[model samples]
Target: MVFGANSIAFFMFAGVVARLLIMWPIGETSLKTWLFVHVFRPLFGSLNGSLLFALSFLVLSYIFMYWLYRKRIFWKV
Candidate 1:
């Protein structure tokens, strides 16, 4: 179920909530803009740009998955 959360309905929920909670306050001019920009821009503020910040997080998730696999670990529940 690792990828189950990314189905269309889930993204719709996330999109709406992200627009309200994040994009609204950050002075984003439009919801047509990417949602991750609002959610990640602050934490990644010093990363120079969204692409680098996103790539860094992607790498981090992959490393974490590999580490877990090496330990024969996976999530349950």
Candidate 2:
């Protein structure tokens, strides 16, 4: 579970980095631009949303894993 969580986190970070790099050249670098860049700019904003979703999933998965471990529970199919 730790490995899975770490892998998800790694991918999320990588995606965010790639997005920032892509936007760097065209970025306005202003406060208003920064805010607008996310919503008004589709490509820039989609990646941000993806990263946020992945991070939230990773956190929830880790919490569930910890809970299962503490309860000494395991699932079998």
Candidate 3:
């Protein structure tokens, strides 16, 4: 499996880190809201903005993963 345990764990850890540092912080903008305000709201309307943002984020994540794979930078257990 190209996407093995490390990949899953990396994403989970990233989510935790994002929440801890960015999303969950007091008086700060969460990633989703920032995307909506800056990128999605302008290109797509409010109704579809959130969904498109999520899809775009997923695509970008996969692209980053592929880049890391090409660089042989897989996280170890």
Candidate 4:
């Protein structure tokens, strides 16, 4: 039972990471528009209208989820 629950959580995390990767390489403008304006802008100093090889959502999501995984964090309903 414990193994099953762990496996489900593992796969759920994998799926979320995969979805993020598939939707990556988002435009700078799109990020600015969709995400919070003050969040990353202050932290990263903006994308400067970069297009090619820009900061991707996939990379960010993987970093975030990997950190959570390392911390043994999980969300339950």
Query: Model 2 scores what on Cα lDDT?
Result: 0.54
Clashing pairs in 1: none
Instruction: Write one digit per residue (lDDT tens) for candidate 1, span 1-77.
Output: 32243334334444565456444543546442444565556556645556765575556545555555566554444
Writing each residue's lDDT as its tens digit, candidate 2 over 1-77 gives 54343554445555665466556654547433444456444654666756664565567556756665567555433
The lDDT of each candidate is 0.50, 0.54, 0.66, 0.51
Q: What is the lDDT of residue 76 in candidate 3?
A: 76
Error of 2 at 61 (Å): 1.4
Q: Which parts of model 4 have CA positions greater than 4 angstroms off?
A: 1-55
Best by TM-score: 3
| Cα-based TM-score, every candidate | 0.37, 0.39, 0.58, 0.33
For candidate 3, the clash count comes to: 0
List the candidate 1 regions with Cα displacement exceeding 4 Å.
1-48
lDDT of 3 by residue, 1-77 (tens): 43552486458655764565455533467665765787888889887887897677667666666667777777875
**lDDT value, residue 57 of candidate 4:** 48
| TM match of model 4 to true structure | 0.33
Model 2: lDDT of residue 57: 52
Candidate 4 residue lDDT tens string, 6-77: 455646765776566455645644433434344555555556423312445445545665666677766556
